[model samples]
Target chain A: MIEIKHLKKSFGSHHVLRDVNLKIEDGKITSILGGSGSGKSTLIKCMMRLLDSDGGEILVNGKDITKVTNPFRLAAVRRHFGYLFQEGALFDSMTVGENVAFGLSYLTDIPKEKYPAVIKEKLAMVGLKEEVAKLNPSELSGGMRKRVSLARVLAISPKCILYDEPTTGLDPIMSDIISDLILEMKKKIGITSVVITHDMHSAFKISDYIAFLYEGEIMLYGTPEEFRKTDNPYVRQFVDGSSHGPIQMKLMRE
Target chain B: MFTAIGKVMMNWLDQTGGAADMVRSAGFWLARSRFEFKQFVLQSITIGVDSFGVTALTSLFTGMVLALQAGNTINNIFGDPIFVGTIVSFSLIRELGPVLTGVVVAGRAGAAVTAHIGTMAVTEQLDALYTLGTNPTQYLVIPRMGAFLLTMPVLTVFSNIFGVIGGYLVAVYALGVPGEVYLSDITTFMGAKDFMHGFIKAFIFAFMIATVCCYKGVSTRGGAEGVGKSTTGAVVTCIVLILVLDYFLTAILAAFGI
Candidate 1:
């Protein structure tokens, strides 16, 4: 289980996450859903120690990694988590196979001869063919890039998976494909997963629990079923994808 | 007005503090991490080998111009142009060779490092690297630093030789001076310490350019516009710092009786 306590992060005076708290249960999917700038991404970054919290503690299976400053020990903790970034974030310099082989090449004790096989195995896991591994990220479509990113993540064989805006730029069909993959990952591997996305359909379809972050705090966190019955107008507005709601959209006025 | 000044001062202090922090971390990582030997060698090829053409041209032209111009000064004083070789060799070896290479490489390689690393930062690749348990400092900064440290001095030596040859061409063929006069003067005026001083400057310039450029890169925020801004900022910062560092390093070296 991963636990985030009183998590606070700010940029200058504008606090992005304030007093946010949540517990992510082991071997379950927890989708952190929020509107733009609602701090869902920040929360995930804080948990992964990509961005430090101003005031918070993230206990990963009982160890608080924010305080783990030793590079080797930090790497040991980080090795257990796989991250799929918002834009796929494949290295531009390397081809798909090289990107997939990166972590294992640098950080692991894997034999040099097995790299090609390992790369192929991870690519196959993400529904990518071995031939596609030779292609650069620029050659792949957005969906293909995301899948390649997923393959790269799986290359490390992490204990937890963190996905930030997993379906951001993909078509609806592609989004559904990613959503399905998320579900398949959970069912098969049974790893702890934290997904940050505003796509409620993907969130509802894949998440066992949903966390609605607003103005740097968890305004609502419960099962998908609990969210369906909640009276909170802001939550309702976001879930329904309606323009008229409690959440106001600011515009320029003459 | 006082408050506004104070706010500006605060921002300056903040940025300086951040740069200092990155320097300290980069230094620590450079010390602690296992040298990625392959990366160091590849970067040596990239930073040293690739930039050879432009660096050579700069050295050759600089020495030629010094011969053409300064030969006149010696002619005016001595009634002959014999001392042109000595002056040109001395100036090229002690100052112009390393400084020119540093400036040119700062524009070429420094901007490249910033753009590449800045693009990675904006695209969340750095964050991804961190999540994959890779230290960005070790993977990105250290190997590049090592490459620069090893190659910059070597490049300086090459630059010095090319520069002297340029001066020789101008003096012997263009100015109608004897080749033996040029060669003998070089042996008389130039020594190991002059060459060592220039090489030492190359190392310092390499260190600053790598650190500043990488710092600008890693601190990039926003998006594509941020990457552009960081790249531009890096090049400008590198040029200015190389010039400023040249003066300070020279002064420091002079103080040590070099």
Candidate 2:
């Protein structure tokens, strides 16, 4: 389990995350739902220590990871969580099989001889054929790339998986397929998941608990049912997808 | 004006600091022996072998031109193209060979390194490496630095040899300076110290190119545009530094009687 207290992050004067406090329960899907540029990704990056928080306590295993400055210690902590980038972020120079085996070589004590079998198993887990591994990431479709990314993440067998906009840039069918895959991973492996997404339909379907982040703070934190029934005007505006609300988008004028 | 100047100074300090930090991190990983040998070999091919053809061509033409010009100037003064080979050979071995090779590699291979790594940066591939419990410095920068440092001196030696041959061809065939005279001039005038002077410069330039390019790449922002800017900046910075540092290095080496 991970708990964040009064997390604060800023880019110069413009604060991206301000006083964010939440708890991510173990072995469950927790979706951070927010509008674009609403600091959803920032919050998780801070959790991962990819971005340093201005002030916060991210308690994991009864230790404040925010204070962990040693690189190896940080890496040991990072090994516990897998991050799925928004665009898959697979190595373009590597074959899909090599990409899947990359993390295994680093993060685990898995024998070199077993890498092929592990690659096949992880690919199978993500519903990709063994032959698909020989191909480059560029040849894979958008949905396939995401699946490959997930397979690569799963190859490391992380305790928790962080998905960043997993369903973005996919058609409805493919989006639903990714959503189902997330659910399946939860059911089969019981791995903790923290998905950052603006896709309401997918978030509503997969999230066991949802946190509505508005203007860099969690305006609402509850179950899907609770989110649907919430009376907070900000949460209501975001949930209903209504344009006429207090949640106004800042636009740059040319 | 003051604000703009302050901003520029800050930017320079920031980049220098970033490059220093990267060098320290890469050094830490290297001390732990975390880098792979296979990666070093692959990067050697990319940084050394891939750029060799262009380096050879550039040095060849430079040698030919140096021979021809020296022959013309000597002929004008003494009514014979005497000492043309000595001039060509000495200049090529002591200064031009290493400096020209450094420039070629910096423009060709160094830009490529920045572009490849910069593309990865914008694509979040660096972030992905971190998530995979791998340091980008260990996986990417170390091998490239190893390849550059190992290959630069070797390439400089080859560049010098090829340049001498070009000078020989031009001095003998074009300028009617006898082959024996050209060969004897090189053998008599040049020594190990002259070669060492250039080799040391090549080694230093190798470090500069690798560090600057990798620094620009890892610190790249924005997107494709950012990659372009970083690549350009890396090559430009490398070429300028190589030329600027060559004078100081020569003075230092000369003072040490290298």
Candidate 3:
């Protein structure tokens, strides 16, 4: 379980995250739902310590990780969480097999002889063929790249998986397939998942709990049913996908 | 105007500090034996073998031009080609070879490092490495640094050899200076210390290029345009610094009687 209390982060005067507080329950799928540039990614980056918080307590399983400055200690904390980048940041220099085996080579004590079998197994788990491993990331399609990135993450067998905009830039069918993969990961691996996304359909489909982040703070935190029934105008506007509301979008024409 | 000057000064200080910090971190990892030898070899091949043709060509032409000009001037003044080899050998070994090789590698390999790492930076592969419990400085910067430091001096030595051959060809064939005189002039006038002066400069220039290029690459932001800007800036800064540093290094080496 991860607990974030009064987290604050800013870039100069531009307050990207302000007073964010939430709890991510263990073995559950928690979706941080927010529109573009709403600090959803920033919140996760801060949790991962990819971006430092201005002030906060990020307690992971009763330990305050925000105060841990030692890189080795931070690596120990981060070892439990697998993060999937928005664009599937696979190493372009490596083959897909090498990419999948990368974390295993660094983070695991597994014998070198077992890497091929493990690579095949992880790629199979992500529904990719063994032959796909020989190809470079540049040859793969957008959806395939995402799966390869997931397979790479799963190679480390982290306790939790963080997905950043997993369903973005995909066909509807591919998006649905990715959503199912997330569910399958939970059912099979039983790992906790935190998904940052603006896709309402995806967030509604796979999330066990949803947090609505608006203007850098959680406007609502509840189940899907509760989110649908919420009275808050911002949450309502976002949930209903309505253009006319108190939450206005800045547009070029405006 | 004062505020603008202060802002520029702050930016300079920030970048200098950042580069120093990165080197320190890389040194820490290196001391712990965290680097991959395979990466070092690969980067060495990329920096040395891939760059040999251009470095040799540049040095060859410079040597030929130096011999041609100096031989003609001596012939017109004293009615004989004199000290052509001495002038070419001294200039090429003690000054031109190291500086030219440094600039060529900076423009070629240095730009490439920045571009490759900059793309990785914008694509979040650096962050991905962190998530995989790997340090980018250890995985990326250290091997490249080792490769540059090891290969730059070797390339400079080759450049010096090729340059002397170029001058010998021009002095003996084009200027009618005897081959024996040209060879003897080089052997008699040039010493080990002259070669040491350039070799030391090459080593220092290698460090500067590696630090500047890696710093620019790792800190790259925005997107493709940012990578372009960083690559250009890295090469330009390296070339300018190589020239600027050569003067100071010459003075220091001279004081030490190197």
Candidate 4:
């Protein structure tokens, strides 16, 4: 379980996250829904220690990971969490198989000779053929890259998987495929998964619980059914995708 | 006004703290970066291959220039053009060859490596490495450092031999000096001490260039413009450090009566 307490993060004079608190239960899928500049990405990044919080306590499995000092131990803590980057973040220089094996090779004691088998298994789990392993990331399509990235996350056998806008830029079918993969992984490995996305359909489909973020705070947090029934104006506005509501789209003046 | 100044000072302090954090993070990454053997080999070849032609050409010209200048000066003083071989070989091997090769490599290889790594850093590939539990420094720095350390002496040796040969060609064929006399003077005058001095300088130059280039590259910000700036900065800094250290090393060597 990952717990965040009284998290506050600011960029210069502009506050991104304000007195935010949340919890991600073990062996469950939680989706954070927020608009652009709504601090969802910042929250995940803060939890991962990719970005420093101005004030907060991030507890992973009852231990305060935020204050961990020793680098190797900190690395061990980080190794337990798998992060799927928004851009796929696949190393362009490495082959798909190599990229999948990247985290495993670094974090585990697995020998080089056995890596091919591990890579094959992980790729196969992600629905990629063995031949795709030798192809560079640039050669793979966007959907394929996302699958490869997912394969990489599973290869590490992380306790929790963090997805940052996993279905962004994908067609509806591709998005559904990725959403299904997330659900499959949760069912198969029982891994706790946290997905941060603005896509309401994707969020509603895959999430067991949904947290609706507005103005750097959790405006509504509950099960997907509760989320749909929420009378909160912000949550209602977001869920219905209504233009004439409390949420106003900023106009760009030329 | 006082309040504004105080705020500025505080901001500066904050920036300094951030820089310290970045340095600490870099040290951690450097520790982990050492594990990727394949990346190390690729970096080594990248640093060495392209610079080979330039290093060779630079050494040849440096030798010829030294021979021409020393030939005139020594002829006027000793009335023996043959002594030019000793002067050329000794100077080239002990100082000029290593220093020149270092400068060439800095411009050719150091800048390229810095830009390549710096772009990767700005693109968040470095962060990706960190997230994967791999240290950027250990993976990136160690290989380049290893390549620089291993390849530099070889380049220096090539420079020294090529420079001497260039001088020999000029002395015997171009300047009408006897081949046997020039060859014998070069063989007799130059010793292991001179070679040792050159090799030592080469090692120091390699460390300086590799470290400075990597530092500049890894520290880069902004975007493509920042990468370009880092590349130029690495080459320039490497050249400056090489010259500065050469003078200091020469002084130390002289003090020891080498």
Q: Per-residue error at A51 for model 4, in Å?
A: 2.9
lDDT of 1 by residue, A137-198 (tens): 99999999999999988888888999999999899999999999888888888878999999
Q: In candidate 2, residue A95 scores what lDDT?
A: 100
**Position B198, candidate 3: lDDT:** 90
Tens digits of per-residue lDDT for model 3, B66-99: 9999999999999998999999999999999999
Q: How close to the true structure is residue B240 of candidate 2, measured as C-alpha lDDT?
A: 91
How would you encode candidate 2's per-residue C-alpha lDDT over B55-120 as one tens digit per residue?
898889888999999999999999999988789888988899889989998988899999999999
What iRMS does model 1 reach?
Answer: 1.3
Worst 10 residues of 3 chain A by lDDT: A245-254
Looking at model 1 chain A, report the run of 10 residues with the lowest lDDT sum. A245-254
Off by over 4 Å in 4: A11-14, A236-254, B1-38, B73-82, B256-258
Number of colliding residue pairs in model 1: 0
After superposition, which runs of candidate 1 have C-alpha atoms over 4 Å from their true positions? A249-254, B1-13
Candidate 1 C-alpha RMSD relative to the actual structure:
2.2
Q: Model 1 Cα displacement at B51 (Å)?
A: 1.8
TM-score of 4: 0.87
Alpha carbon lDDT at B139, candidate 4: 70
DockQ in order: 0.75, 0.92, 0.88, 0.57
Error of 4 at B204 (Å): 2.1
Evaluation by lDDT, superior candidate among 1 and 3: 3
Question: Candidate 1 or 2, higher TM-score?
Answer: 2
